[model samples]
Target: MFYRIHQFWQAIHPIITEDELAWVISLLPAPSLALFQGQPLPEQRHALDVAQDLWSSGIRDSHLLIAALLHDCGKTRYPLQLWERVAIVLLQKAPRKIWHTLSRSSLPLAASLQAAEAHPLWGAEMASHLGLDPRIVELIREHHTPHSQEGYLLYQADNRH
Candidate 1:
């Protein structure tokens, strides 16, 4: 709950230093950087924190860093407003069947929720289309249900944000 509140604060006052932006730029290729830049400021801030968390934890794997930075790129596909994002979090507490059902709903905000729910897959596809490393794509795809140690670590960092 506290984390969600913090996320709300972040959403309102998303701040990233020029140096931090520079750091992210240095880490990504042109295509990947464009994808990162396409995210909302709040999402960009969250991604930076997630990537920084991985770096500070002694994980120097390039793919891990990249995946951490891009995990939410798919969120840009059907972007949500602040209220919608909050509602999505609340909606997530329900069963998977419920979420799946909601995703199928044609009601307003349902598409946004569905997009948020499926960002992992979409981000992975984006990464693959961008010709990024397979490791990075896999990490983004499985951050929600990790299939590798690195992916698990990425998921951990993302959850912290």
Candidate 2:
């Protein structure tokens, strides 16, 4: 629980250094680098950390690294404020019917909620449109699914920080 709180705080105020940006740019193509830059600072930091974790774990595949770096790019479409993120977390525990109703409501929260729920698919579509490798697109689309070994690693890394 405390870990989650720490994450929430971090998400609201992400800190990225110049060296980190340089390192990330070194790993991606020009267009993909633009997409990475489009992400919120927090998401950017998270992606960098995940990719670094994968590298430290001896996973050297460029596709996986790129996937980790851009997996949450979909969230850029509907950026959420800190409170909205909290609400989305709480909303996940609500019944499906309630969730659907809330998601469809006229409230501004609905957009962020919808985005949070659909980011994987949206991110995958974006990646595909950008002409990323099919494997990278697959990883983005199924980042939360946790069926394959790579997916599990991504999921674990995401949760860790």
Return the clash pairs for model 1, or none.
none
Alpha-carbon runs more than 4 Å astray in model 1: none
TM-score: model 2 vs. ground truth: 0.86
User: Candidate 1's residue-wise lDDT over 61-140, tens digit each?
Assistant: 88899899999998877788888888887887889888888778887877887778698999999999999999889999
lDDT values for all models? 0.89, 0.86
What's the lDDT for residue 61 in model 2?
Answer: 86
Candidate 2: tens digits of C-alpha lDDT, residues 1-161 = 88778778778788888998887988887789989999888889889988998889999988888999998999988787878978987777789898899889999888887888899999999999999989899988888786678888887887676
Which residue pairs in candidate 2 have backbone atoms (N, alpha carbon, C) closer than 3 angstroms, thus clashing? none
How far out, in Å, is residue 12 in model 1?
0.8
Worst 10 residues of 2 by lDDT: 152-161
Q: Any runs in candidate 2 off by more than 4 Å, and if so which?
A: 93-101, 104-107
